[model samples]
Target chain A: EPEVTQTPSHQVTQMGQEVILHCVPISNHLYFYWYRQILGQKVEFLVSFYNNEISEKSEIFDDQFSVERPDGSNFTLKIRSTKLEDSAMYFCASSEGTGRGGRPGELFFGEGSRLTVL
Target chain B: AQKVTQAQTEISVVEKEDVTLDCVYETRDTTYYLFWYKQPPSGELVFLIRRNSFDEQNEISGRYSWNFQKSTSSFNFTITASQVVDSAVYFCALSDFNRDDKIIFGKGTRLHILP
Candidate 1:
């Protein structure tokens, strides 16, 4: 089955540095999302994007985090300044749905990008 | 506010045993969908099942079954004759049908099956 793909399966960067995590969602999907999980922690929602605008976001997705679909296939999440708390495995997910409710969409997730900040 | 809770942090069973994982969720959206996923040691999230708000019908697929109760806000999963391969972290997720939002996950329940 076709699946979402993420680049740099693992990333290590210095604190206060900028890092851009890349993801290519499944083709023909309309919605995309970013989530992160610290070691042995629950996966936390970051942001959701649809139709070129951010549909919704969580507090974990603060000003330091931004997402853009710069191209047709690339969905990138950039952290302007990384912190120790930013170290986690980031996952990208996509879904196929157009309008509203009643179980219209199901999300498929990527393998995830492991980020380690020192 | 929406929160998905899986109280059982870890469960262990022998091979060929039947096990059930409990998941209770709290969501303001009366209309939503419930999902179950498995994450193995590889850190990959595997989709297992999805149940809509309107559908209270219980479903059974292979060795897996799900019980969706709107009254209790609980969606529980069962594995019959579980095997060693069934060992993994199971997560319960909820998604309000806004069409463009992401699914929120509960703290996963880790299952360990001994051979």
Candidate 2:
């Protein structure tokens, strides 16, 4: 089966450093998203991207966070300055657009990139 | 506001035991969707099932079954004759049909099937 893939299975960075996580979504999907989970907490929605722009974002996705579909296949998330609280597992997901052929809102998630900020 | 609540933090069951994971969700939208995902120790979110609000049907697939109740706003999953391979963190998620871009997930229930 085709799957979403994320790079940098694990990353460690110092506070105030820049970090970027990469993801390659399933080729035919039209909607993409980013979510994060603190070590032992629930997964939190960060942002959603479609049509080369952000569709929606949460409070957790503040000024420091940015997402880009730099190319047809690559979707990237960049954090300008990482903080200790930023340590978490970031997941990239994609889905076929809404209400297509009875399958609606089903997202395929990547293995996740674990970010550790010290 | 949409929220998914997986009240059971962790559960341990002996092999061959049947286990059920509880999930309660809150959503104001009349049209919405609920989902379940499994994350093994290897750390990948595997899609299990998706149920729309209109369909309150109970579905069974082999040893796995899902009960979706719109009246109580709950979507629960059950595993019969569980095996060690069933050990994983299970997450229940929700998304509004109108705003289908992002999904809200629960804290997840960690299942440990002991041999």
Q: Which numbered prediction scores highest in lDDT against the true structure?
A: 2
Candidate 1, residue B6: Cα displacement in angstroms equals 0.5
Candidate 2 vs. true structure, TM-score? 0.97
lDDT per residue (tens digit) for residues B1-115 in model 2: 8888999999999999999999999988999889899999998898899888899999999999999988898899999999999999999999988776778999999999999
lDDT tens digits, residue span B23-108, model 1? 99998887787889898887878888888898999999999999999999999999999999999999999878564376789999
Q: What CAPRI-style quality would you assign to candidate 1?
A: medium
Native interface contacts kept by each candidate, as a fraction: 0.56, 0.77
lDDT of 2 by residue, A72-92 (tens): 999999999999999999999
Report per-candidate TM-score of chain A alone. Answer: 0.94, 0.96
Worst 10 residues of 1 chain B by lDDT: B94-103
Poorest stretch of ten by lDDT in candidate 2 chain B: B95-104
Off by over 4 Å in 1: A98-105
Candidate 1 lDDT over residue span A74-94, tens digit each? 999999999999999999988
